[model samples]
Target: MTTEPAADPQAGKSWSVEVYRFDPERSVKGHLVSYRVPRLEKMTVLDALAYIQRYHDRSLAFRYACRLGMCGTCTVMVNDIPRWACRTSIERLGGETIRITPLRFLPVLKDVLVDYAPFFAKYRAAEAYFVPGEERAEIAPISPKSRERRAIDPNLECITCGACYASCTMLAHDAEYLGPAALNRAFTLIRDSRDGARAERLAAVGGEHGCWRCHSLFNCTEVCPKHLSPTRAITGLKRSIVLDRLRSRLR
Candidate 1:
């Protein structure tokens, strides 16, 4: 059998962790398990989980890949808010206890591992793929400085970590809802000068589970790791749709 890596002795020496535990193969309902860790400089919440898994218990379940926060797989609810544990330093938590749980809107596969199928499904339903036309060779070169392109610049940095989806109340209430991230993706395409799918994308997001469902609670914006605001993008889509409707009426 392979041995698990040892915990760093210098990590936070006097912090308590409360982990939400659920195993379909082993647990009846689910439970919160607590672990105490040693204090160290600049330790993150991911490091705390790593220490618990290696030294305190071997069966605890959580998901992580890149320890530096780029992979987006290490997102979890810390102190009841969705955040990337890899980037959340223990010292910044401002408390003696840290509570960890799976993302809110998705089904939990285990302790902190949420099923991403529903999240990705919404993404696919948004028709987020690029649509090209036969006249691609004749297409004029587009400048990034164009007003429309610049409008979508902030949205392109999304890592699709599902943190926004997890914190969205609109998605929690309506399972069929296409969430902020997906709608943001739609906005990007809609704003693109070369895209041929504007009408189709607008139709996709114009229905019940579309842009109108957003309540502007800003939860997605609050939890987003990249600081990109899908809320603003959704608002922009609403304005565009409203203007288009008015223009059609005038015609």
Candidate 2:
């Protein structure tokens, strides 16, 4: 895919890119490989990666889809910070050299690609999915201004991007800890009055390596593409757990 571009004065400018390379099926170790990329106006990190994979080295492997950042396929560490590659412009990066690497604290299946199984497993452990009650004749209308809806609103937009999970110091220390996204998901489900598994889900998130384990570092919130606040959700869980226990003792 070594395609010569049409005449343009900006063609002379290029970005220095260093991408991590690995193939578990073949090699036991990995290394960083560098390439020179053309400077296109408002170009993104994903654009650079595609250029490398196509015009430079077909063997280079990375994942991407829906280049609009809705899909987390192009998630990677740009200069050791977790971010969506498709949305990160080179201009925003503010440097001529771009360093790309895989997300940390997960098994790397290939270059810049981490297995999402562990991240998702924690969500399952937290019982993050909604457990609906018996089927009804009609859908129940939830008020937009209701307390439950308001509580669930700010923390409900998680994209499952794993940027928070990757940047989390808590997860790095204790792998058993239910991380930001999973805990955030649990909070949303717990706040829904219609969910059948409120007690069970609340107990799950309030237990060991659960919401209490979070240090409120806010790393997840910082890198969140959708601007969700998992730290705050965890804190809400902590408050709910305490109140629920106090009520039980009083009763």
Candidate 3:
């Protein structure tokens, strides 16, 4: 007589979670470490990480702030796609497996934590700060229907998560590329009529490493956690560059 094996009740409730492990302090090179995690109702990627941190491994390193997904601090590579860990649910990813890693284009500081120096450096190179139009005594009124405002509004909700910059294919190839986040930031300022730095800002984002270099593959738009479109902004900047050069020739 053949005996039938009993089916485990926990069969479909567990997942294979592989996280990229690295720690220069411990002399461990980067590699993926697997963890078997049990499924919970509506559990998020960040929740899984938190569970691992609390129960399985105490030495694992990751970053998160404003667990509500407001700070964009929990950004990581989830199955080769950059995402906000706090907001990405396990159920949405098929509940079978998950792989987490540091931003592909940035230097890894530790296990999933990346150094954002280069990302912000390119941001500063674009002169992203507002060279405010003469100090306003009160709120300077900008019409909602104005063409410039319309062009600039959609691109301004960026959380500076470095997700767009990290996912950019240009950065994967060229280390010096200004990247989508920087160029997108420059576009916002350049389109503002009240801003005094149009010429300088244009120069900042228009050189060999600037908006003209965007491949327009839409990778930046795809991986952005905030849904901001850096491709659209870069295209607008390219148009402005052409128009600016023409105006200069006419003058």
What candidate 1 gets wrong by more than 4 Å, as runs, is 1-12, 134-142
**lDDT per residue (tens digit) for residues 197-251 in model 3:** 9888888888878887889999999988878899999998899988999999999
TM-score winner, 1 or 3:
3
Q: Whole-model lDDT for model 1 versus the true structure? A: 0.86
Which segments of candidate 3 are over 4 A away from where they belong? 1-10
Top candidate (TM-score): 3
Number of backbone collisions per candidate, in order? Answer: 8, 0, 0
Which one is best on lDDT?
2
- For candidate 2, write residues 157-210 as lDDT tens digits: 677888989999987789888899899999888788888887898899988889
How high a TM-score does candidate 2 get?
Answer: 0.92
**Lowest summed-lDDT stretch of 10 residues in model 1?**
133-142
CA lDDT of each prediction against the hidden true structure: 0.86, 0.88, 0.87
Off by over 4 Å in 2: 1-12
Query: TM-scores for all candidates?
Result: 0.89, 0.92, 0.93
* Model 1, total clashes: 8
Q: After superposition, how far is residue 127 of candidate 2 from its true place, in Å?
A: 0.4
